[model samples]
Target: MRRSRKGQPVTEIFKQLLCFFLHGTSRHLVFFDTLAKDAGYAAVIESESTSMLSSHSVKRFFRSFRWPRIYLFRHLLQRMFLWRLKLEAPDVVILGIDTMVMDNDEAKVRHGVRPTYKRVKGF
Candidate 1:
C-alpha cells in the first residue's frame, strides 16, 4: 500500500537530472516550462505549470546546483572508472623524472606571477 498524506510532493530534482542527461538541452525558464509541459508536469502540478523557474532562478540553479557539484562528480567518476578499466593512457611520449624543477609555469607567464608555493614558515 502506498503511504499517503503530505503537504505536497517535493519538486522533482530527478526530472531535472534526467532532463539534462536524456535531452541534453540546458534550461532556460521557457525551456524548462516547455519540457515540463511536454513531460506532463503541467498536468501533474496545477500551480507551477507556468515556468519551472524564473530565468534568474534558472541561471542561479545552473550555477549553484547543476554545474559545480554534478559536473565534478561525473569527472571524478569517469577518471576512476577509466583507471579501473585501464583505459587511460598518457597521450605523449613518456619521460623519466631525474630531479627537481617542475617548471610548472613556462617563461611566457609574467615574471611577478610566480607559481604559488606551499610555504612552511620561517626558514
Candidate 2:
C-alpha cells in the first residue's frame, strides 16, 4: 500500500464517505470526481484550516486498507453498536442484511470479477 503525507483527518474522510453514501447517488468511486467540484459538499466537510481531499487522494486512502485493517474496523463498529444498544435499550430493535451485485461486464479487466447466478459478470 502506498502512503502519502496525511492530508485529511480520518474523521473527515469518514464524514465525506458517509455523506456520499447517504446522498443515495451513484455508488461509484468516480462520484468523488463530481464531489470534488461540489462547493456545497466542501462547505459541509471542510474546516477553516482543512479542505476536503481530492478524488485521487480519497481513492488512494481507500486503496491503502488491507483485510486486517478492515476486520479491525468491523470489530470496532460492532463494539460501538453494542454500546449504543445498551444505552438506548429500546423496546424493539430491527436488523437488516442485504447484498448488492455490481455489474462489471464492461470492466472485466478489473479485479474480483466473477460469474454470478444473475447470469452476468460482477463482484
Which candidate number would show the highest lDDT if scored against the true structure?
2
**Across residues 12-108, which tens digit of lDDT does each residue of candidate 1 receive?**
4434545445665664355754555453654444345544433444454456555667888799998897785576565654559775434434345
lDDT of 2 by residue, 1-123 (tens): 334455776777787888778987888878877877777777776533235556787788898888999999899999999999999999999889797887778883957656885777876
Candidate 1 all-Cα RMSD: 12.5
User: Which residue pairs collide, candidate 2?
Assistant: none
Those runs of model 2 whose alpha carbons end farther than 4 Å from true positions after fitting are 1-6, 45-50, 99-123
After TM-score superposition, the amount by which residue 83's alpha carbon in candidate 2 deviates from its true location, in angstroms, is 0.7
- Candidate 1 residues lying further than 4 Å off, grouped into runs, are 1-11, 24-29, 38-56, 65-71, 83-123
- Steric clash pairs (candidate 1): none
Candidate 2, lDDT over the whole model:
0.76
Ten consecutive residues with minimal summed lDDT in candidate 2? 45-54
